[model samples]
Target: MTGAKSDHVAAYIGLGSNLDGPRAHVTRALHELAALPLTYLAEHSSLYASAPVGPQDQPDFINAVACVFTRLSPLALLDQLQALEQRHRRVRQRHWGPRTLDLDLLLYANLEWQTPRLTLPHPAMRERAFVLIPLAEFAPQVTIAGKTSATLAKHHDGADLHRLLP
Candidate 1:
């Protein structure tokens, strides 16, 4: 989603995959994100292996976070993420079900706004170690409501998060 905006803001995106070669799906999604028009993949956290948050019968997921600089607004960025998911053959057959690729807009320039389509700072991010651990790796200092990711991660120590890649 290319636009006329010249200013770029920092945004954090959460990526996860549990189907069709999980690792390969995540890696390919990262490349696609970096190739987005007017967007730059500034940083990425190490991949982690985690149990599915829902539907325990599904395969485990490989997860990571990407910090990107982009000129696209929140909605446009969300559109691009959904488009990327569609390209990867994502299906909405079940809630939190296994997927080929899942892209979530975790945070957008620290902006706190929400619409029917998306939410800022990801409502469940703090409680999910799969998101916090990797996020704390590169963005330990990022805060939501004055709480740092490092602190949030510490709070979720009981979560089933295992580092799978450097």
Candidate 2:
């Protein structure tokens, strides 16, 4: 981050994978996130195992959440994230297909944004147990739209999730 420390924005990133040794991909990604330029990883949640949200044929996914303080604009951070995904050999053969890594910008400093390429407070994050369970670990009070993470997470049955590591 550059300029005043006030310039830094707290961003939440969700991580998941089901291919190429899922646990290792997620574990390595946690370290890689800390390496983002002008960015610092404030905290990260433990790994979790969950059923895939889309196709049922693929293996289960390993999921986690992270909070980062960064100077990069939302899109810039997104670009960096996509690049990291590519480094992991992510292939987009189909929607929600199995991949080596998946990184999502779940929230960006409580800002709501939209563009052809991306959206702040990711569209589906509110409903994903994989995303919420881990997010609650570091940011239970975080509010998106009119709901807080803790409140939103409260209603989920959590039967779809299994904590894997701390």
Candidate 3:
């Protein structure tokens, strides 16, 4: 006999924070992310310290990527992530400025999509070592935008990553 179908779909979420207790923000965000409807936090990599990428002169960011299993649609998942950000009082006053928390949907079960409000495979995940490293650690064989995490990290060279042990 076949088992009952699970209402679970795998996804990747990128977590980052650089202000108001960066480490605490990341930890809290993970808990909040798991609390979303039809979702479970499957795994997470240890945080990493990454140099700011845009608009130099910002605090170094604490970053990690989470693996989640969820039945929520991509848009719905995005909505929940935004709500978690708001709960932490995340602000968007400056581009890449410090914030309490930030959550980004990095990939959604190999589904390729782009909309005015969101994009899967994150559009820029391949070039960022911070994202690629944690992702490679958790799901090395997973493909994103037609490339494996290993390939993405190989192309990246991991120049500005410093692992943050928790």
Model 2, residue 16: distance off in Å is 0.3
- TM-score, each model? 0.93, 0.95, 0.93
Instruction: Write the residue-wise lDDT of candidate 1 on 1-166 in tens digits.
Output: 2331358888899999999899998988998999998788888898899999989999999999998889989999999999999999999889999999999999998799878989897888878889988999988988876898888888887458888744
Winner by lDDT:
2
Sort the predicted structures by lDDT, highest score first.
2, 1, 3
Score candidate 2 by lDDT. Answer: 0.90
Q: Judge candidate 2 at residue 14 and give its lDDT.
A: 96
Estimate, for each residue in 49-133, the C-alpha lDDT of model 2 and write its tens digit.
9999888999999999999999999999999999999999999999988999999999999799999999988999889989988
What range of 10 consecutive residues in model 1 has the weakest lDDT sum?
1-10
* Winner by TM-score between candidate 3 and candidate 2: 2
Clashes per prediction? Answer: 0, 1, 0
Residues 33-120 of candidate 3 have per-residue lDDT tens digits of 7788888888888899888878767788999999888899999999999989998998899877878888999998878899999988
lDDT of 2 at 68: 91
Select the stronger candidate by lDDT from 1 and 2. 2
